[model samples]
Target: MMILGLVRWMQPVHGYDVRRELLSWGADKWANVQPGSIYHALRKLTEEGLIRAVATEQVGARPARTTYEVTPVGEDEFQTLLRGFWWGLSEPLDPFSAAFGFLPALPRSEAAAALRNRANLLRANVASMRASLESDWIRNSKPVHVGWMFELWAARAEAELSWCEQVADRVESGVSYLPAELENAEGWSAWREGGAPLDADPE
Candidate 1:
């Protein structure tokens, strides 16, 4: 959907330009836009008849580059995807959420320390985002909505940081999870020793 939208917005654009534009917009960081997959995605979209190659240019000694423009079908699909995402509130899956389910497997001190480390990382990310949003280039050259994207990302990081800190504090000060006996079972001891992952449904 993102690639289709970008192609529609910047018609007659090359895959290199599209990839660069997405990276410039920090889409790779926030969205599922992988730099390596952009070219493949363009080819796939062309194959699917959603985008058509309008021109191919070759500079001597360099690979040929094809320019693309979205089709009417692509435009309609992009609009449908955009509207669906806007009207929905689906949350991205976080690995932390899955790990949190087995929180009792770790000692309280280790869990608290890990959460603190995560909080620190989030703090750094938030600071970097704020710095970018305040940069002269962002303010003068980028669209106003780009700043809003940074704000949204920073706000989410801040919220998660707060939650991490709160959880760390509670864990450090003692919060009930599983019964002590179960937590210290032979299986849990093996997991800690072997660093084994839990099954979706452990017997």
Candidate 2:
């Protein structure tokens, strides 16, 4: 999606230039761009008749480079990709699932505190990233709606904060995520027999 928009914004650009522009706009840090993927996408786009080479030029210190422009078909393809990107929604893919699965070991009060702390951290991050997202670098960029990406990010951050608060409340109220077996003695021996450890301390 970015490549399409970028090529449309700056036609007659090389893969390296695309990479450089993306880096300048901090796409690697914020978006799903990989520096190495630009050339590959360019090749694929050319093969798919989305973009066509227009000229070759040699700068003083840089190697000769082939420039590309979006074809008319590429404009249509770009809109397709852009619309698909904007309309698509996905569930959160958090990396903390594994740690959360083992979270029963902590006492309820401790867990609540930790969750609250996480909520605060996420709030701070949301605030900071929002400031940057609203900065000229993003707002002045193409599409005028680029800031919408960060707006969605902020919304997710707000959702996460709410989830953290809810989870903290649940932990504090003793309505934890622990399974019934972990909360009862009958579950222990059976769980042990199933080769899972009964070392879980549902404090």
Candidate 3:
């Protein structure tokens, strides 16, 4: 997604230039963009007719580079992806976590079943991330910054799995709903206290 964004930002950029910009953005610290994946995405986009490749001549010993430009189709797709990314970040809680938090709104048996299902899904995701983090492709030749990002993602996945287990335990123990009084007045008060202040009346 970042690569696509970069391509859109710099209309005629080559693969090497894209790699350089990734480093410039401190992507190594905050993002994971393997060399192969970068090349692969560019190739895939070209093949899909989403981007056009133009050959540029070099002056010195450097070989000519193939610069890429996003097509109209690519621009529309990029905007769609960007909107989804922003929406996911702005949500107060992840969908998976939110389901667990509001399990009381569901029937006792059904909620318990749903909690177990989500826990299994989370556990599988954690294991998959761990395996990817430990793979030779990621550990050996990949840059330290990129590897660190994988590690960070794996850590977050593990933490989420732990939370899922805790929720499961609560569900299994027959703790179904927050008390009506607590759900109403207390919950509303706590929510208002933590939220941003309301705007003053307009003069």
Give me the candidate number with maximum TM-score: 1
Whole-model lDDT values for every prediction? 0.84, 0.77, 0.68
Per-residue CA lDDT of candidate 2, range 1-203, in tens?
78867888888788787888887676887778889889898889889999998988998988989899999999999899888867997566677776677555566667788889999999998997789786888777755565776787789889988999998897777653546656456545433222233464323
Per-residue CA lDDT of model 1 for 88-131, tens digit only, reads: 99988989999998786676788899999999999999999999
Give the worst 10-residue stretch by lDDT in candidate 2.
189-198
Worst 10 residues of 3 by lDDT: 194-203
lDDT of 3 by residue, 7-63 (tens): 988889998888877765457555567656787889898898778897766869887
TM-score against truth, every candidate: 0.80, 0.72, 0.48
How does residue 32 of candidate 2 score in lDDT? 81
Rank by lDDT, descending? 1, 2, 3
The segments of candidate 2 whose C-alpha lies over 4 angstroms from its true place after superposition are 71-76, 97-106, 133-143, 176-185, 188-203
Ranking by TM-score: 1, 2, 3
